[model samples]
Target: MHGPSPRRPPMRAGSLRDGMTSRRDRMNHVVLTGDRPTGPLHLGHYFGSLANRVRLQDTYEMYVLIADYQVITDRDLPGSIQRNITELLLDYLAVGIDPAKVIVFQHSAIPELNQLLLPFLSLVSVAELSRNPTVKDEIAHSSQQAVSGLMYTYPVHQAADILFCKGTLVPVGRDQLPHVEVTRLVARRFNERYGEVFPLPEAMMGEQPLLKGLDGGKMSKSRGNAIALSATEDETAALIRKARTDSERLITFDETNRPEVANLLTLAGLCLGRAPRDIADEIGYGGAAALKRLVTEAVNEFLRPIRKRRAEHTEGDVRRILAEGNERARERAVITLGEVRDAMGF
Candidate 1:
């Protein structure tokens, strides 16, 4: 016989502060996660995770971060860095991310938040930093002479980002579980060593299967496998046009054998909310050219309204939205920073 269904544990005392809050407190539990914003949101973004962020906004207190400083950890160019912050925000607004629901703020704005970083560094050892899989993977990829201290201790920095907000839940993809684990470790050490000032944020992990790029490899902008969310219809159409496919005239979605075709089918599936195989079968009967054409049309059509919405926006509007987001973020940051100061006996 099946056992009783698992129950959600009671919300912590901090979450109970909602009893004092207005607006039904749908935000009893806060969720925090962000892209490094090294580049714009891309097609793989839509298929895998953007829709979930849109939906989760109503369910959790959300903070969508422009990790402007973190971007410099990997990419050190100044001009590219400044341009990306604006472009990343534009991408966020284009894809129906409401600033009212989800705060869209930059890391640089909350300058005081960096103080948490120093204490966090002391909690984790140099050996622990060297062993972090992400740092190792990044170092492996780059034959650069020296891995910067920021990049090496990036996990602790991530912990600062999460704990600073006292975030209770963080929605992250599975590959990032290790990072979340590191944050939890920091929380445990902090509470044990200092005080229970920050919540051990739980990983509300994203179950969305990792979306691969058109080349069937990891979806990344640098790889040229990306379809940028802000790209024009003509631009998106051209990218899809160049999307690699199999030699055969006939088409069937076999992700293992025909990953390129399957990737396209998956994109179509995400838009129409159907299984990739099902969409593949419906369109495959007309042969490869037809399948390609159908996907191109559907994707462009789907992106059309979003791009228009983006176009209608102005820099002033974006600045205003970010200003609102910044204020909301700063309000929370003030409380947490105050608590941190008290904890450290300042």
Candidate 2:
């Protein structure tokens, strides 16, 4: 069911390449980035996008959305969503995503946001939606025997998520490039047909866009291959111990031939801020056990401060943060919806 990886396209707007002398110059760029509260975030989440968000919050008008409404697209229950949202907030704060600089809100909080979906749904064809590789990949991997209506129109809902807030930049992995493209198309079409209301959002990628799972596949919480940010020190060490590595005694960072080992190396490299190959050379002939030990140490040390900050937060704090962010998001959504309505003569 896995499809060929798509080539990463150049950013259509908000190219960080443009020289901006001051923070004031960067303030005009708006960034929409977030995660589904399906489970707690993992190291892959850290290196892939969360890390970039931490860095981007200072420069851009950042909106970190917890896509709670999208949880129902593939699942039947919403029981754990509340818990997952709390965990996500804790992870965000621990990783230096300042609530003051970034608006972290849930999907269902802003009614006006969802109101944009109806108009956006009209902007794209069913064929275009079906052609989205990210949606197709999700459908192919989903547990549901039949794709739900919500799952089919997931990209359009995402378009609402981005356009409702006038998001000009979206931080995404390569797999998600298509979804951002869908948002761009929706914005372009809405502006062209109606008036210039939405900005064509661009996709921003991190140095490490996709991190492999411990088993050398996609890193996912459901698959039990990811080490959650909430994981205790012992839990992280145990997970790293069980990470799949080849029998070759010499450790090397060859992503093509030795992906499992290379994944572990990548984890360690990301944690220690060093080249994976250099780490490999240092641990040459040490085999998988030594490599795992190094990774375990690096990961635990890196997460020590983050996990400590995470534990210091109470559920009430998370709720309050969400409430404030939801209010902010609603204010923005109301303005955008008014513009859309005026353009459509609604």
Q: Give the per-residue Cα lDDT of candidate 2 at 56.
A: 72
Winning candidate number (lDDT) = 2
| Model 1 per-residue lDDT tens digits across residues 215-287 | 6677777667888888877887787777778777667888788888888887776655567788777875576
lDDT against the true structure, each candidate: 0.71, 0.82
Candidate 2 colliding pairs:
none
Instruction: State which candidate has the highest TM-score.
Output: 2
Query: What would the per-residue lDDT of candidate 2 be over residues 15-67, giving only the tens digit for each residue?
Result: 33342234454468789989899888988777666666776777788999999
| Candidate 1 wrong stretches, greater than 4 Å | 1-27, 140-145, 285-287
Worst 10 residues of 1 by lDDT: 1-10
Backbone collisions counted per model: 0, 0
